[model samples]
Target: MRLALPTAVLVTALTACSAAPPAAVTPVQATPSSTPSVTASAMPRASAGAGEGLPAKLRFTQIAQFDKPVAFAVRKGDDAVYIAEQGGRLHAVKGARTTMIVDLSAEVSKGNEQGLLGVAFHPSGKWLYLDWTDAEGTTHVTEWAFDGTTAKQRRDVLTQDQPYANHNGGQLAFGPDGYLYIGLGDGGGGGDPQGNGQKLTTWLGKILRIDPRGEPYVVPEDNPFKDTRGARPEIWAYGLRNPWRFSFDKETGDLWIGDVGQDSWEEVDHEPRGRGGRNYGWNAFEGDRPFDQGVEAEAAVEPVITYQLGEGGSCSVIAGYVYRGTKIPGLRGHFLYGDFCAGWIRAAPVDDPARTVEVGKVEQLSSFGQGNDSELYALSLQGPVYRVDAP
Candidate 1:
């Protein structure tokens, strides 16, 4: 569920809607954004802070290994770590004691990027929210009350129809403003076939925000497009292709996204706290390049860092948190990231963009999780989650 599409990739996913689907492609047409302009921002190098990105070499000690683990969640003030497997189960790990909080295999779809993709605590850690694709390939967000003994009170929060099986960018996290943010792919087909990224009326290809505690869901009062005509009230940001992983800086509250490219590049986008409604050109512009010569919107934001890879070098970018942990004296304030194909870990300053420093590596790096105290861990696709440690 996390990758690129060839320029000529064929469609092979199930299309199950009664009426015409959003991304249904027969005769592809172009929908121009509100403003048609293009700007390719160059990566700028900045000076590093004192003792920042200074660890000569880092170590990744194996903490535990799980069955194809994909997502991770840690409760505030708790030592236990929750690991979600693509096989549909949540494992709670505290020291040597491991227990199953819930099993969702009966509910989630398997293979080709479908499974338990994300989990978030209700700020207070009293409620657990899970985002997964059901067996039929539709995205579902559910909630459960947690008290450490049993995960109770199952509640279905939201659902979205997926036209294709791939490109489900399922990453769930609560924003600094307290709204639940859900990242969804553009209904799956290659090259924004559905036009969901720019079409505000649909939930696909966009970032959605809702209050899960409400009857169905509550859109925040100041959500950017809440009152715009022909727009879905829950849409916060639009025009992203497979935002595989994203995180909010623990200290700055800014949003950082690792948007997998169409075929040539990978990017990391940043948004200042409270800044929503921004368009991140997808098919129109792919990571600082005019993908199809389509004019991009003037307001369309550019990525903070954009890098191209050779045929088999490194492609998909997996974004991680800015190290605000105290344990690693040198990594503080540096944003860490990796590639699914290339397991090497790298970091760059939040205030600075271009210059990057190599950190460490973990094979099949899928996602990174932060402990309650801000310590970081890398989840690998090939078993073995690693704890980021130095000295």
Candidate 2:
């Protein structure tokens, strides 16, 4: 029951120029033309840390594989894992068995970085939510009821006209507050072309929180912009480029946002559970450094962790959750993350602000998921989903 807008109408709506002026912001650092070199020694290996008490020998095994699996969610009490495919399908995984739960290929727009992107389940386990790019290339957030075995009864809850396909942010999760939060990329093209990242009038380039129990979802009265003029009332935070993945610390409810960078840096921003309405630096700044000098006057939030694309032998940061699963007691409280191209998995205790030690490595880590038992699992773009257990 997702709503479909004609492609022509979407194009016209996105192209309609807005009269609002661009906010002053700093410019991002220039990207180098050549690819940076990575030494063989820089590559990571499986290594256990004293903090998480991981076993001496650790390895990963494939549980399932798909054409282009992008995101996954685990039901609270059920053993099945819900996997989202970029080609517009939701696959359910129970133990080693897999089955198709829903298909929306006709409504989905599959192109460069645009398709079925994210999925999540309500805490009550009664509903599943999906985020995707529609045929016209706009982002849509929809919810469907889960009747134990299959997904039934769909509802198109929210849709945002996208200017371009490349930077459509696609991560969705229900926070501890029982509110669903959706991430949207800055209207795409090169370098945030439309200047939507800092624009309050639009929901593009924001982390939006809404109560889905209402018709088409309702904006929470406590939203940051509840009293602001000309601002999208549902926005929880603004000024993000393309937040590819974000997660709530299962225990703390704090939010961890991984924003993809243009050329110089990849960043991870932390928002404590109750805080909202913050502005992350995008066009005016990349990471902690200033990009555009003009936007410095506007309040900007800094990332808790950042690394240069080339310096750390990494590119395209994939943000992950802190391990709170029971399988690896030693890894509990460790923040696990990896790079799309580097093919390395590393975990540093969340308590360690400096991230001094490495927990271990996983080859070609694509996405991370936590099970109903609180155990951690790692999905490989070209490999299997492995249970992150003690060696």
Candidate 3:
């Protein structure tokens, strides 16, 4: 869904409560389009202690593993988890069983930060979308039909040329408006060598929203540049460096973006849904500070929150969702995010003035997944998917 304007910020001070125990796991049908049937009440909040602010009593159990899993999405009514591996394979996990759903090794361009990079499922669960780099080093977004057992009817919907292999931001998701949003990085090489971030003619360095349900994927009529001259009508937001990942809050529809920085800072941008046409200062500014004097004053946008590279014990921030899951009441309304390099997990309650609190920590956290129930899952780069539960 598109976001409205930023609203008033809300702050609350939370104290420690006991960790509520976990409930028994009830088996549910493993279908491709149905939501998972796991129902557990929120765990009691545990005391907030030292060491990165995660509750001292929190722990995680490995439920499943994936090989080089880069992105994942869950069906709205299905217990199954769909994972995208960097090696060009899509895998499905359901009730203790995992299987390959699609293989694209021949079409994938695998390397340093390249390959199958993102995946999303249609709200209807009948369609799945994938973003990846092709053998020619360009990025392509494709859609596939999914039956209960396998993926068929592959169709390439969007393709963009790439200058380098590294910064091909291949993340895809369907917004609340039912449009597929694709994130692309500045044409690779260090320092925006191709100058794509500041250029509006190319699809690179921008967030694009398209109606993939149509042939050739039509651009939404209201896209910011639909009537502008020499601009890609599909562009939603521009001037992004490498927006590795982005997500919309299920409740508020706010877009949380994690854009990788050049040499100094990594940023997290919060764009209220529906607020397009804003330039997320990239080559002009890095994380609210001027990076290039010439472009800094050119009406550039700013990130709602940002962190320096080494501060707060984090490296690359993995943008995540605000908790709406019933499994953890205290975690409700909290935005749970992690550091890909530091393997640290932290939660900041949305709009909470206490913006620096760390709610929990997961070891070797590579990515976060959302289930059909809206519960969050933490995936370790090595393997194992842990349901983000309370203590």
TM-score of each: 0.87, 0.84, 0.83
The best-first sequence of candidates by TM-score reads 1, 2, 3
Cand. 2 TM to true fold = 0.84
| Superior candidate under lDDT, 1 versus 2 | 1
Model 3 gets an lDDT of: 0.69
Question: For all candidates, what are the clash counts?
Answer: 3, 12, 13
Estimate, for each residue in 218-317, the C-alpha lDDT of model 2 and write its tens digit.
Answer: 8899999978998989999888988878888889998888887777777778788979989888878877677666664267877766767655456666
lDDT of 2: 0.71
Report RMSD (Å) for each prediction in the order shown.
10.6, 11.2, 10.9
Candidate 1 structure quality by residue, lDDT tens digits, 261-366: 8777788898899899999888688887877556454477888877774333465678899889999877888888876665667777777855566666665678
Looking at model 1, which ten-residue stretch has the lowest summed lDDT? 16-25
Top TM-score hit: 1
Off by over 4 Å in 1: 5-42, 45-53, 295-298
Per-residue lDDT tens digits for candidate 3, residues 259-328, read 8776566677777889987788878877666776666424677675566664544556677777787877
How much is 279 displaced in model 1, in angstroms? 0.8
Candidate 3 wrong stretches, greater than 4 Å: 1-58
Better of 1 and 2 by TM-score: 1
- Which one wins by lDDT: 1 or 3? 1
How big is the RMSD of model 1? 10.6
**Which residue runs does candidate 2 get wrong by more than 4 Å?**
1-58
